[model samples]
Target: MGGNLSAQDEPASKRVAAALRGRIEKGELAAGSKLPSEREIASEYEIARTTASAAIRLLEQEGLVLRQHGRGNFVRETSPLIRLGGDRYSRKYRGGPTPFRRECERAGLTPRVEVLAAEQARPPIEIAQRLGVDSFTESVLQRSNLYFADDEPVQVVNTYIPWAVAEGTPLVERKQTGKDGIYGRLEDCGHIMTTIREEVTARMPDHREREMLALPGGTPVLQVIHTSIDQNQSPFEVTRFVLRADRNGLLYQLAVD
Candidate 1:
């Protein structure tokens, strides 16, 4: 407890929270170790019991600690790390297991996909633009999926395909895309993808995203918008991927020809 105290201008709860967070980080309080009880913290820190409780609450909100019913708070477990690399999109990889399934297998975790919605709907203006369709004149097949690694939600994906291409395909069906995934199906439909473009950005999660991803307070999410184009220079699919910042690392490899 003899570490640097918070700035004088900081609130009492913040000061207490900082000290505990330092301890946790420094391994003074290891994972699964119980934190001081509110009464004990109040007595030791010479602060009101409510202030001590607030400090603990702050830690809980940060995902650094978890409170058990009738029991005190304990340090929470760290999440598994996942690397999303460019090689995952290779035709060879697609011919075998989906990238997500392969990654989870490598990490010894179960991978599961829950189809939230699969239907034909008018695309959002941005999606329509990416798909080379007029929002007013065309409808797109939209498929939303929630991906889990060992029961922990890690990503949300929304895929949009022009109705002309997906109207009679499995992309509009509420089921797994099988071993080859959507790209393989697209190829089967005579739309062989020759290029893919992805735009990535980061921001704080919205309320629904926070709940769906079970993110800690102050955690940021990564958004990736992907467009697949066929050899004919026509866009075939547009997908929006929402990933947990703390759990995934995105990697892109460029061949040095």
Candidate 2:
């Protein structure tokens, strides 16, 4: 039978996409399963190859499919979700695995982090404002890292600490920051970590981010601007995290008074 469509009123492209979308949602196609080629879909649907292509494009724009450069389109992978929450930063885990590692381990995935850069530098205007730095020319220690889960890139983290707070500290000399990650070192310098604030938003990824995350064209990145407050009610650290929307999730449980 040729073009055996369930509905004949809609455009040919949408009908084909709807049929395929049904299979995807029903688990008939399954995650990571390659979709039939446009030509194959056209043959099966008895529609023009261009119409078949348009159908596949619709699925891609909706994030239901991913097109590898050389390979074909496949359902997006949905397993091993790395979740972030307040518990990830618990002080009890300090002097050991970082938050990223702990979350990955909890999800039963291997974790890795690469320090892309660590140095003392002038802060951006927004970062300066967040840190309450008066002089933009004053230096702040910056640590840039790329986090991975099971060898797949997941997020980018850039941390900034005021020079007045970071100067003459272990944070200036070592990437590891000695123990307990940066919090332990900051506490050693007398900035007790007592509270945190995270502002989250979503936006389209730039070219560099797209390449770094190996994201498909229609994907967007989740931006989280994190601020750490100390016992003195001072914001000592500001971190900008760019996470892939597909591989990571957010969970927050707050107590309301």
Candidate 3:
């Protein structure tokens, strides 16, 4: 990073971060480029190492830099795989790659999914309410999937189906129930999807999620909860998507009502 040594209206940390951020946007510091150490930045700007570290932290929070354990900080990957919102479930997109795989291929990246677990588990109180199950001890069939792009884990999707609906179907299988994906098997079981309700929130990840997604310390995750309703106005399926805030984005295209 090269810039004149001078004071600005902002604080020293913000000023340093802005300088580095500008170069990153201009491609002067290309993707995956290793950033200078905090000590180096401190020496250059005549600021404390803490200030330098704070500046780097700012960039990381903005999803412009990546912090890897045992390694140094670097520019974040430029290309991110985007979720096509509700359109991903369109029946027209069936018979080929799932929405996730298609997004990776469209970005010229390889996509892979690992079925982590398929078992009946008792739903949490929050989940139980959404599934309309008894929170006391009722169980729901859960299929957990870990999606990756270029071999890096990006998100974990956990889909829950009532045991009454998944008891004897492929829904209990570890692999995809069908090329059309879970919704098809859902429709087969008479749970025809009519409306989808999605809610997105952001919060720090738990230890398991942090380790699963290989996320850095202090990074947050986007939690997208989806509820699929049937023709009878009953919520049949609920999926919780934990997406890496740094590597993923959600795009929603809705009609102007």
Candidate 4:
């Protein structure tokens, strides 16, 4: 066929890439199968050899294919494992602006948190259970915040701590002067949170999150339910965080029993 392209007149490289992508997606080019040479593809598609090479390179970069030095390229047999909702997710930096700041930095994204409500308040039902307290317990301080990235509100988090542990710390005492990181501040008070449990799920954003995050209808939000325990194995904090679905990629690692 002639190079009539499309109304948008996409470049030859993209066109070739698209054609090859279609075949791979449709399973015509099965995973692990070697692709035809660039010269063969160019001849078949009536395009320049450079365009065919570009297509293969694009696929390699996208992790869809592997190019062996002497053996041309083969479709990737397996995709990269994107872990999600795992326990004890480790990061390079221990205490920082946020537990996830290091990961965001690695991905070339800026992460920030806006302290919304850091005052003392009764813990909600969800927070009580994880904190190992009675549902009606009013002896707690609630910390609610809106987390952002690159000016986008990505997560809304609500954390709770029993008053005894929070009363003497800046985490709850000086709500006006927001602490850098709640966990860090807790550690400063000689209560190091050595264990954390997190439960993650994806669901459509609720009205409050939709309005605050300016999320459009049908956009899903990842909900992370977490519980932090101090060195003595006592529950210290309970947190519920809602993260924008499109803004994050969760990693999970599992070990077979």
Best lDDT among the predictions, by candidate number:
3
What is the Cα-based lDDT of residue 166 in candidate 4? 84
lDDT tens per residue, model 3, 35-102: 99999989998999999999999998877888886899999875778888968877787678778888
* Native-referenced Cα lDDT, model 2: 0.86
Give per-residue CA lDDT, model 4, range 1-257, as digits (tens).
Answer: 68666734988777788888889999999998999999999999898999899888887766577778798888766422122445333434454434556555655667776778767676777777778766675778888888676667877888888888788667765343333467667777777767778888888877889898876333577888888877899888888888766566677676779
Write model 1 residue lDDT over 108-137, tens digit each, in one string.
888999999889888999999999886986
In the order shown, what is each candidate's alpha-carbon RMSD? 3.8, 4.1, 4.7, 12.0
Give the TM-score (vs. native) of candidate 2: 0.91
Off by over 4 Å in 4: 1-92, 95-97, 173-180, 254-257
Tens digits of lDDT, candidate 2, 124-238: 8888888998645856888888888999999988999998888888787646665678888888889888899899999989988998888886878889999999988999999
TM-score of 1: 0.86
Instruction: State which candidate, 2 or 4, has the greater TM-score.
Output: 2
Q: How many pairs collide in each candidate, listed in order? A: 0, 1, 0, 5
Q: Pick out the ten consecutive residues of candidate 2 with the lowest summed lDDT.
A: 78-87
Q: Relative to the unseen true structure, what is the Cα RMSD of model 3?
A: 4.7
Clashing pairs in 1: none
lDDT of 1: 0.86
For candidate 4, give the lDDT of residue 212.
Answer: 86
- Candidate 2: C-alpha RMSD after superposition: 4.1
Q: Report, for every candidate in turn, its global Cα lDDT versus the true structure.
A: 0.86, 0.86, 0.87, 0.73
